[model samples]
Target: MLKQFCEHCGEETEHKEVIKQKPSKYGKSKKEQFKAFLSGFFGGVASQVGASLDLIDRYVVCKKCGRKKLENLGDEFQ
Candidate 1:
């Protein structure tokens, strides 16, 4: 369990890992879908590059406050 300060509760609390799903396209046109697909592909590539370069910072949310905060875990070398 991860212990972090919660702004809402005003105290430190243990947090559970929350895995959120990427929202799906509900009512998009064909053209919009194509554009979104291209954008997602390029965005994924860019994120891969950033991850390999250790330029991405990951974070966890506070259990009580639901505040997303990055812990100082030093550099992540892939």
Candidate 2:
């Protein structure tokens, strides 16, 4: 239930939620590996040691003009 001001439509319009995955860094070097090992051993949080990263990119499309744009709608959007 997020409303955004659409430049294309020149008015406020309802937007839809869009989830996108960001490209993750490829490969972990030896140093990174050692750090992960140490963190796992000390912190005991090894579940996602080297998992690929994802980002939630919020976007809004003008229902009237169909213009797509990136928008920051705060935590509720996330």
TM-score per candidate, chains pooled:
0.38, 0.46
lDDT of 1 by residue, 21-68 (tens): 233452377887676566556666665444322333446787666787
Which residue window of length 10 is worst by lDDT in model 2?
46-55
C-alpha-based local distance difference test score of model 2: 0.54
lDDT of 2 by residue, 14-60 (tens): 87656343322423787766665564455443222322112224467
- Model 1 stretches astray by more than 4 angstroms: 17-53, 75-78
Worst 10 residues of 1 by lDDT: 18-27
Candidate 1 lDDT score relative to the true structure: 0.57
RMSD of each: 7.2, 9.2
lDDT for residue 14 in candidate 1, whole number 0-100: 78
Which numbered prediction scores highest in lDDT against the true structure? 1
Provide the overall lDDT of each model, using Cα atoms, as 2-decimal numbers: 0.57, 0.54
